[model samples]
Target chain A: MLDVKAEAAEHSGAGAPGEEAPPLVVEGLGHAFGERQALRNVSFRLNRGDRTMLLGLNGAGKTTLFSLITRLYNHRSGSIRIFGFEIKDKPSEALARLGVVFQLATLDLELSVAQNLLYHAALHGLPRREAAVRLKREIERVGLTDRLREHARTLSGGQRRRVEIARALVHQPKLLLLDEPTVGLDVASRQFLLDHVRMLCNEGGIAALWATHLIDEVDSGARVIVLHHGQILAEGPVPEVIRRANASSMREAFDKLTGERSE
Target chain B: MRPIHYARCLRGIIWREALRFINQRGRFLAALVRPLVWLLIFATGFRFVLGVSIIPPYQTYIPYQVYIAPGLIGMILMFQGMQSSLSMVWDRETGSMRTLLVSPLPRWYLLTSKLIAAVIVSVLQAYVFLFIAYFWGVHPPRLGYLTVLPALILAGMMLSGLGLFLSSVIRQLENFAGVMNFVIFPMFFASSALYPLWTVKQANLKLYYICMANPFTHAVELIRFALYEKFNLEAFAVVGGSLVIFMTLAILGYDPGRGLIARRAGTE
Candidate 1:
């Protein structure tokens, strides 16, 4: 993949130039798991072509936020809009424009790769011929065209993740949400996956929200949202977040902002 | 999503379920063995012990294996319902159910499709058992084979619905085997699946009443009568009524807001 950091820097202004709506807008989002508040008063906007890193440590409510955005869980305390469509009120329309790669691999291990993709396309109500076309294009881009007939369980962890990414893109979503997608990957696989996703945002003009605790995943030009203890501590460009925390590096800024050492 | 979309989704679910069923050879053999054992082994020993009167479906004195064939078919489907519950638990734990639930389609549609898939598999098992029974000397009328399909379908729906209801209540997969044994054995033994109701009443009036009240008894009677091309309105009403009730309950149990699934996930 090409250098996404350079591409994002070239297209620095990720959102529309004074356009009416960005790709995603979340306002006053609050959620709770029973008595425990997983998220509170959290809000952010992801613009078209922007790569936003949802930075937080373990137990920082990152998964909860992703779950709410993806409609895995519903919240009444706040509102979320994707492409100007409210999620709760117009879920089908909102979700139609969104693609998600969960932390866990959701593929049916018993199924072949092509079968898995076809099944997802059917769920999205895509016609078989159109699904086949999209499957070809997406897998080709991910360099997995030859592995299409292989069973999902036989693939390496990174290869399966790539297939998942390709599967998410089969319907051509405008906004993508990934929750700790690189948790179990090796170093090379992590870089490859991150770069591939970043390249998708840069080339396809698709907005992305990548959630992770690792600071290294955040590019200098990417938007950063520092979440801690179920709340947003800071949100801005990488350097600005660092400057606001009076820290010299992203690691120091995360430490000072979250008030916890990154292990 | 349009009507075509719903059709495609249903097709996809059923296709996946059918493929899974076909791949599990052990499940097929186990389903076959359980009912056959009741016929070939247990029925031979107990045939003389329990005297069966001339039932409507039976013109004259019928051997125990011939009498118990339809009941054993019901038993096969009942166990199939439990098997469906096990798969549901596995889906939830493995997170594939999350994928199904996230679809734009309504939850009721997704659940109904799953129930239908289970019923189809159960009916297939019933036919397979019926086929083998012919060779084992437990033969029904030639036309009885044709009538058994509808009976098996209805019985499968009721039993699968009951299984869905149990799955909604059972939280974990590890705990399901004991629950399945508890449910299947009692449902089979307490009903007319093994012996005739009159014989039970002769032995004990209270036990006979209990057997009379058991829905499994009605299920067996519905199949048994249908196997001989006979219609039992009372059996039909009970089985059909119980099917509707259990199906509605199962659908409600899968509802995300107040359902057991939501409650368990929320607590987690």
Candidate 2:
């Protein structure tokens, strides 16, 4: 929808040799809430241009892991690095390259769509002129240019999610993290979002980690991390995981790996 | 991050606060009405019962309405401070706080910017109250109008610090109503807000001691003296010291690694 080719060309030859570290890397990440462990020894990596799906059920610690990696909750037992910058020691550097679409709606309902996008851009330290340009471009790409002046409350669920996706891209982050972004969307909206994110990874060279519990959302060739009970049960391509789980379909593989039947 | 980036961040936060205030027309009306009701009805009824005396800020005996104007200003700031904290709790529940916390800026800077924005809104409300009280036959010295600003800022910051600390400890929105009754009412009533501290001393010694120990009492005295273009060194010292303590505790309370947030990350 955007000038993806031009933007991709701009970033194509930027990184030097040996400077292209994976967009994200988590090592032995563990987190807890008092006596309850939320995430334990979770590890993963996302290379440039990779669109990895982090598949987990409710309370499977997917949100907990995202919180730790996003630095919303501090991790005590492990480390998270973004583009070679450790989150604990170099938070600013690490967070600057991250774009997140939280599970809950975070838009200020009183503020217009453009205002919300501009506020996010300012938070990421974008210059006023640059922020305005990106705000316009991103809103246009999301097909909401005419609705820019409308308050977030006026938009439908799908439109709000699209606006959020556009907001996340305003700062041009290197790593995008979405936690159940399509939870309540319609069939078309869900497909649109999934395709848009995949396009970003394929054309714009941005790496993404999409967290979802829906089994049908995963593509057969894409890398996936199946999490269960605060631990990753499987990691690899879909076919490899299904085969390793001694199942014929992704749904069966997930049920077998998590030791639960799908209702 | 560059200094310019920090400035941009501050501007954005302040702008959002201003926009939210403008959008919430009912909140602004309520902020003004709460103080006005006290100035108009409560003070009018108490005028006959309460006798005025010559205080440091008062050269001669003043009417009950004039005597209570500064207290009402302090009331505006305190109520607004608490109101802002309520919004913070709401923000956390609604998930907007997560967006703010995940920003690249340091947590301290973000929290401070929030405090400063709240203070600006409260100060604006205070000035509007002062303006309305002017037509109601209550007038401080002309210079008092100009001098009361810094005093309001200091008092606003202190009250907001208390508010921020409360918001960090508060778990649910339902608990905030309990806090308003326990924390707000006691602080307002036990202080020298309604009557002079000397009057409280004459009536009950124990109440006078509690009033003296209350930070809200110093905040009231600070505003009371500053509105008359005079300085109260004691009130100034107490308010400033309390501000430091409250702000430090609030910053720690919101800290992710060590404070209450770390203990219970469920709500935050």
Judged by lDDT, which candidate is best? 2
Give a tens-digit lDDT track for model 2, residues B173-241.
Answer: 356577679888899988878889899999999999999999999999999999999899999999999
lDDT of 2 at B171: 67
The 10-residue segment of model 1 chain B with minimum total lDDT is B256-265
Q: Candidate 2 lDDT, tens digit per residue, A1-263?
A: 33443244335432321226567878898887877888889888777777889998888888888878888657889878887778888888888889999899888888999989888887877888999999999889878999999999999989999999999989998789999999999999999899989888887878899999998899985789998889999998889998999999989999988889753
Looking at model 1, give its docking quality level: acceptable
Clashing pairs in 1: none
DockQ comparisons of all candidates to the true complex: 0.39, 0.56
RMSD of candidate 2 to the true fold?
3.6
Per-model TM against the reference: 0.89, 0.94
lDDT of 1 by residue, B197-223 (tens): 888888999999888888999999999
